[model samples]
Target chain A: MSAFAALVRRDLVLAARIGGGGYLSLLFFMVVVALVPFALGPDLNLLSRIGPAILWLAAVMATLIGLDRLFQADEEDGSLDVMLGASLPLELAILAKVLAHWLTTGLPLALCVPLFGLLVALPAEAMAPTALTLLIGTPGLTAIGAVGAALTATMRRGGLILAVIVAPLMVPSLIFGVSAANAAMGGTVPFTTPLAILGAISLVALVTAALAGAAALRGGE
Target chain B: MTATGLAASFWNLANPTRFLALSGRVLPWLAGLAALVTAAGLYMAFFTAPPDYQQGDTVRIMFVHVPSAWLALFLYAMMSLSALGTLVWRHPLADVSQKAAAPIGAAFTLLCLITGALWGKPMWGTYWVWDARLTSVFVLFLIYCGILALWRSIDDPGRAARAVAILTLVGFVNIPIVKFSVDWWNTLHQPASVFRLDGPAIHPTILVPLLVMAVGLSLVAIALHLSGMRTEILNRRVRTLTILQADHPSEGGI
Candidate 1:
């Protein structure tokens, strides 16, 4: 347990010090959200109507941006080889990395949804639910991203490939996350149904990513 | 046969050299069978199957479309099995099979999408709908493309195989989720349609031709896969020979 915590802490510190970590993702998320208003013009109603979707989309994209480095850096420097050889199970180590990724990237993206929500003219009533859905959904994004990251970690110029591989998998999360927010915003479907499904997707992604990511890491080696 | 007996027979053919030799003998026969079956199926489709009561001539496209859709899903299933072979058994031919099947799968998926759109134009009044079934198939197409791209990007065949196998497994798990989400999404937005393609009420006349076409397509797909595996095996042999020649230039004069 302590080792897992230490691994997470080490990744967190590394991300803070690195070039493409928390701050970069936050900036990218903000930029994407900021661009939505300009693209849609000054239609507040349209912006508010689509606010949840835009936020969710930006959060997903932001999570993907940082994923390429999730294992690539360790693989490059030989730390991955050592980790693979260690007594620490690869799946647990992957969970730690994903947790750190969510902490630095997903969590920040979710927390900033409300702030970015204002720029998109998100309705006041939907802000809490939009943030809530993102908070639930972004871990799934990180988990899925980790699988893609592991798959492509050994390749050169893997960023685009990782995005391609990961994006389709993200569809469920996006669908459920946006639906939950829409439900909370007065859609006929009950808010709880989609919300529960969204949470289920996160749990499934977590298990899938850990097992698949470990296998991928071993396979790539 | 018992489970062990079946597995032993499977592993017997898993050797790449043996597979190459065996596939070489079978390829001509398989290709001929594929050609004959497909010709027969096409004849029945065009000459035998009656026009639909509602769709008329447009219903004929279903002969091609439905089979391609089935092949698309079928090839993915084959790849997933090969993925299991690659990961669990480390079968030598598993990677070759997975790599060979990807582009074929993608092509079938594209065919499925285009034909689906063509059918939708006359039937649904729009060529495209964010309807659940259509959307899930589209996602399937994207997944196929992603797997193909992953296969191409990695240089090492062994490493690429493992990575691709893992990705394939991940995609397999998500297929059901995609289907469910799209189903739920469509349900929330629109009521179920009265005329689904695989509806329970298909006429025997139409069903026979559809089944024939489906079998024909499966044969053609198998022929194509066998041909691809042959090419992949040859490519590996060529790669090995080239490396050997480079190492000992005097022994083999280019």
Candidate 2:
């Protein structure tokens, strides 16, 4: 338990010192949202209709941009080897790494989504759902992305490969996230269904990553 | 009773060597079966199967469309199981099966998409609908291509297998999502009919042929897979011999 915490703490400290991967993801997200208004003209209604989708799309891309780095840094420095050598379970190590990744990339992206929402001409009511969806869905991004990160840890061109592998799985999360935002837009039956499904996806991703990543890591050694 | 038992034992020949040997002998037969069955099925599909009251001659596309679609989902499911077998049991042949199945699966998926579009053009007046089923299948295609690309791009076979195993398992999430997307979302695609709680919606006339084509395609896939496994095993042997030659250059008596 303490080891897990220490791993997370160490990762956080490292993220802090290196300025994290947050800013880069946010820059990508913001730039995408910023471009949407120009592409659609000044038509507020048009922008609002696609506002949630644009936000969700930007969030997914942003999360992916940082995902390849989730395990690459550890794999490169040989710390992953030492960690594997430790008595601690690889599953726990994977969970810890995913958590740290979520904190650095997912969490911050969720935080910055509302600002992107505004740039895309989102209605005020949609902001809460937009942010909320990101909050719930981002954990799934981190969890599933870890599997890709682990699998492609040794590949030099892992980023593109990671996207190809992970993007399809990201569909459900993207669907629900945007659906929740769209639901919030129309004030329909609360965003509970999508939120719940998104949470389930994250749980499943967590378990799957733990098992698959452990096997992958062992094989890598 | 003993002969019957001996016949059933054939199913247990799951090793690559045995499978390759058996397939080597049976490949011609299976290929013949595939060609004959598909040819008969297509004839019935285009000429015998009456045009749908609603869809007209364009319904002919259903012959290819339905079969390819079935193969797409079926192939992925098979790949996932092979992936599981490889990961859990370290079944050597399972990796070969997965590597072989990917491109075939992707091809089926491509055929499904194309035939679907061709069908859609006259019936729905659009080649693409963004409907729940269509979109999910599209995503499935992407996943299939991704796995195939991953398998091909990685140089080391063992590493490639391990990497693709994780990928295939993760991507399996799309299967259930694709199955239920229509119920979950308000999309243009029709909901499930064949395997639904209410039973298959289509009449027996269409259903029987669909079933035959489905079986035929499965047989073809099996045949293709067997031949592919044979080639893969030979490739592995050639690789090993080359490595041995590299290690003992003087042993060749030059």
Candidate 3:
């Protein structure tokens, strides 16, 4: 238990010190949302309508922010080798890393969705739900992205392959997140329906991604 | 008793030399059958199948479209099993199976998409619809591309096999989600009329060719895979020999 906490804490401390972890995704989230208006022409109504989807898409892209370096950094510095030999199981250690990663990268981005909602001219009623979905969905995105990260942990340029590899895996998260957020806006479907599914996806992703990432890490050795 | 015997025989074939020798004799027969069956299937598809009352000539596209679609999905199933082979059993042939199947899967996916589009143009009056079924297929194609890219990027065979095996497993898990989510996202698409059998009448004219084409394409796929595995094994031997030759300049490698 302490070892897991320590791994999580160690990752958090490293992310905080790195400064590259959180803000890059936050900034990306803002940039992508900010660009949508320019691309679509500053139609406030349009922005409000597609706000949830735009936020969701940006959130998905943002989730990929630090993933390439997730395991690569550890792999490069040889800490990964040490971790492999540690009393802590690699899957648990990876789960901790993913948890820490979601905290620094996904959580921050999700929390800021409401604030960035202003940029998209998102409706007041929809903001909370959209942000809520992003909050829930981003964790799954990070977990799925982590598997890609572990696969390319030893590669020189993993970022290019990372998005391609991760994108297809992210379909369920995107579908559920966007639909759930849209559900909040008002429709025959209740908000809780897709939201529940989204939560389930997050839970599944957390388990599966950790196992997969650990497999990649061990297999690479 | 038979099950254990079958399992024993299966394991014995894991030796690449034995696999190669076995496949070598089977290849000609497999290739011939594939060619013969595919020709028969195509002939049946194009010539025998009646034009649909609703769709007329465009219904012929289903013959091509549906079978490729089946192969696209079926190939993934085979790849998933092979991925299990690579990861759980560490079968050398499994990775070769996976590597060879990706391109074939990709080709089938591309065919499915193109023929789907061709069918859509006449029936739906549009070449593409951002429908649930189409989107999932697109995602499947992308997954194949991603796997192929991953395989190429890694140089070490053993490591690449493991990494890609893990990736293939992830994809296998995700594909169902992709299919389900897309189905939820758009239930309005995939017109019932287009499928023909959805109309409460199962016509033998349509059923026979579709099944034959499916079996034919599958055989073609298997033949390609067997030959591909053979080539891969020989390639690995060459690679090993070259590496050994590099080690000792004075002495030639076997």
Candidate 4:
């Protein structure tokens, strides 16, 4: 347990010191959210209607930014080899990394969704649900992203490939997240239902993706 | 035979040289059978199957579309099994089978999508809808392409195999989620109409041809897979030979 906590702490510190502590993802999230208004034009009604979806898409994109490097840095510096040789199980190590990633990237992205929601002219009623859904869904995104990162960790330039591979698997979370937000925005279905499903997806992704990512990391070696 | 005997026999064929020899002997016969079956299936589809009461001539496309869709799902299932073999059993040819099967699966998926659109144009008055079934199949196609891209990007076969296998397994786990999400999304938008639980309600005349076409397509897919495995095995042999020659120039002539 200490090793797991230490691993997570180390990753958090590394991300803070090196990857700008989620500031980069925040900037990227803002830029993506900013582009939607320009592309769709100044129509507040349309923006408000699709605001939750836009925020969700932007959150997914932002979460993807530094994922390819999730394991590559360790793999390159030989820490990954040592980690594999450590008394700690590979799956637990992966869970720690994924947890750190969610903290550094997914949590910040979720936190910023309300601000971006305002920029997109999202309805006031939907902002809380959007933020809530994102908070639940983004861990699923980072967890799956960990698997993609591990799969492509050995490749030279595998960022695009990792995105291609991971994006389709993320469709369920995207659907449920948007649905939950829309439900909150006065749709027929209750917000809790889809939100519950989104939470289920995140839990499942956390477990399965950790196992798969560990297998890929070990298999690559 | 006992379970171990069966397992022994299966692994015995997993040997690359043995696979090459066995597939070489079977390829010609399988190719001929595939051609004959497909020709007969096409004949039955065109000549024997009567037009749908509602769809009329447009119903013919189902003969092609349904089979391709079935094969698309079947191929993915086969790939998943092969992935299990690769990762759990470490069978040598398991990765080869998975790699060889991906593009063929993708091709079937594409065919299914195109034919589905063509059928939808007349039936639904639109070429496409975000309907649950159609959307799920589209997602399947995207997944197939992603797997193919993964296979192509990695230069090392062994590493590529393991990576792709892991990815395939992950995708397999998500397939159910994709289907369920698309179904839920569809209910929010519109209900599904393609196929339903109490059976399709298609007539025996149409059903027979559809079955024939489905069998024919399955045979063809199997034949293609066998030939692909053969080519891959031969390619690996060539790579080995070239590496050996490079290491010892004097043995190059042999």
Residue A54, candidate 1: Cα error in Å is: 0.4
Residue-wise lDDT of candidate 4 within B1-254, one digit each (tens)? Answer: 99999989888898888888888899899889888988998999888888888889898998898889778888999999999988998889998999899999999999998998898887888888886667777888888998999999987788888999988988886456434654655443233233568676667888888888888899999999988888887887778788898899996464
Count of steric clashes across candidates, in order: 0, 0, 0, 0
Where model 2 places Cα greater than 4 Å from the true spot, the runs are B1-15, B182-187, B192-200
Worst lDDT window (10 residues) for model 1 chain B? B186-195
**DockQ of candidate 1 (2 decimals):** 0.85
Residue pairs of candidate 1 with colliding backbone atoms: none
Q: Rank the candidates by lDDT, best first.
A: 1, 4, 3, 2
Report the number of backbone clashes for model 4: 0
Name the 10 consecutive residues with the lowest summed lDDT in model 3 chain B.
B191-200
For candidate 1, write residues B1-254 as lDDT tens digits.
Answer: 99999988888888777898899999999889888888988898899999988889898898998889778888998999999989998889999999999999999989988987898888888889886767777889999999999988988888989999999988996556444554555432233222366673677888888888888889999999999998998998888888899999889654
Ranking by TM-score: 4, 3, 1, 2
Best by lDDT: 1
Q: State the number of backbone clashes in model 2.
A: 0
What TM-score does candidate 3 get on C-alpha atoms? 0.94
Off by over 4 Å in 1: B1-9, B177-200
Q: What local lDDT score does residue A48 receive in model 2, on the 0 to 100 scale? A: 86
DockQ of 2: 0.69
In CAPRI terms, model 4 is classed as: medium
Reported per model, the fraction of native interface contacts reproduced equals 0.88, 0.68, 0.79, 0.79
TM-scores for all candidates?
Answer: 0.94, 0.92, 0.94, 0.95
Worst lDDT run of 10 residues, candidate 2 chain A, spans A19-28
The residue pairs that clash in candidate 4, if any, are none
Highest DockQ, which number?
1
